[model samples]
Target: MRLLILGGTVFLGRAVARLARASGHHVTCAARGVSGEPVAGARFVQVDRDHPAGLSALDGERFDAVVDVTRRPSHARHAVAALADRVGHWSYVSTCSVYADNATPGQRADTAKLTVPAPVEVDNPVGEHADFYGPCKVSCEDAVRDGVGPERAFICRAGLIVGPEDPSDRFPYWVARLARGGEVLAPGTPDDRVQLVDVDDLAQWLLYAAENGLAGTFDGMSAALSRSRFLAEVAAGVGRPDPELTWVEQDFLLARDVRPWTGERSLPLWLPLPEYGGFLARDVTDSLAAGLRIRPIAQTAARTLEWIRASPGDVKAGGLEPAQEAEVLREWAARQ
Candidate 1:
């Protein structure tokens, strides 16, 4: 199989290229070449997707499959316009954030209501316009499906993707914290739900869809797990199975100004309950049934820790510093 990845220098795209190469598929990665380097085995084509003619370098090229992981609607539209006719299968990596109702759990991709697509003027979503991220993806999904038609388009609505080479701090924070081994400050209740897909697992599924010509929309993540199990598996994976975890109430944490998800003074992957109950607890039964294989969290955690150790400077830093955690824990204990 001949595979072409549109943005192959970064996380998920790189994973897909690497896996495709290893699977004996001839892989070609087309990118701006500024983010990161593509895997050693795949062919690299330096092309800018920001302009309409940027992809003209590959004028007569064709591929068995093309995987595009672009947040910009313009990029998606340009790729589809340039290569939709020649590519055998088109896979667009989208996010679960496109769903309009995040408070309701167990919503399937086919039945869920999607947010409004970005307006025609908004090309890039950044900083103050961050909320446009999901909507832009919706526009991108629309372009792919409309360009290639549903029979040849695979739309993957991915959840929180975590594993080795992850550019986010959400999952890696737990791996590093657990490896430290001490009185760790855990957020929310132990029963709070969590969901994520390993990068390799997601990449494999994308390849499977391309190889088998699977079409239609589906969430891309593992089955949801309790927060306690999530942390325990991570700890065990990092060789700290018995760390002391102090589960703090959500109200207390929020009152103390501790942020949720990723960022400074934040507990990564810890979102406020009820409001975001469905965000991390998506029903991926259809995804699983459609060849999305999920490995154990322990395995994902251990591999992530190894990657962090090898590339310490590459991991993005945005979690509770030890002192902030200690201070929050101290406050919580006092309230208790």
Candidate 2:
């Protein structure tokens, strides 16, 4: 199969290109060559998706499938306008953020209410307009579906994607913390839910969808698991099986100004209850049934640890430092 990936330099896109190449598929990655390098074997075509005629370099090219992971609605529209007619299958990597309701758990992609698409005039939503991220993705999804029609389009609403080459601190924080093997600060209740898909798993599913010509939108993530199990599996994966974890209550953590979900002084993957109960607890039954294979969290964690060790510079730095965590634990114990 001949596959073309738009914006294939970063995380998910790079994973897809690497997997596709290993699977003997002829892969072509078209990007501006700024973010990161494309997979070693896949052909690279430097093209700027920001310009109107940027993709003209691939003018007469064709492919069996094209996967695009552009957050900008304009990029999506430009790709559709330029190559929708020639590509046999179109896969748009969207996000679960498009769902209108984050408070309700177990919502499926087909039944979930989506946010309003970005206004036709809005193209690049970033910085001060970062809230438009989800809405812009909605617009991009609309562009792909409308451009290629449902039969030839695959819309993947991905959740928190984590694994090797992850550009976020969310999952890696736990791996690093657990590897240290001390009084680890586990945030929220042990029963609090969390959901994420390994990058390779998601990439494989995307390729599966493209090869099999699977259509329709579906959430791209593994089944949700309790936070306790999430941490234990990660700990075990990183060779710290029986971690002495101190489960911190949300109220206490919030009171101390400890943030949630990726940033300085935050417990990554730990979100406030009720308000974001559904964010990581999505129902991916349909996705699993449709060829989305999820490996064990232990495996994902171990591989992520290996990647972090091999390329420490690549991992984003967030989450609580040791002193901050010790202070928070001290305060919590004092309150108790």
Give the per-residue lDDT of model 1 (tens digit) for 1-336: 999999888899999999998999999999999999999999999999888988998899989999999999999988999999889999999999899998998889999999999988887888877989989999999999999999999999999999988889899999999999989999999999999999999999999999999999999999999999999999999999877999999999998899999989899999988999999998888999999999999999999999999999999999999999999988888888
Clashing pairs in 1: none
- lDDT tens string, model 2, 75-126? 9988999999889999999999999999999999999999999987777778
Which residues of candidate 1, in runs, are more than 4 Å off?
A: none
Residue range with the least summed lDDT across 10 consecutive positions in model 2: 120-129
TM-score for predicted model 1 compared with the true structure: 0.99
How many pairs of residues collide in model 1?
Answer: 0
Task: Go through the candidates in order and give each one's C-alpha lDDT.
Answer: 0.93, 0.94
* Regions of candidate 2 where Cα sits further than 4 Å from its true position: none
Worst 10 residues of 1 by lDDT: 120-129
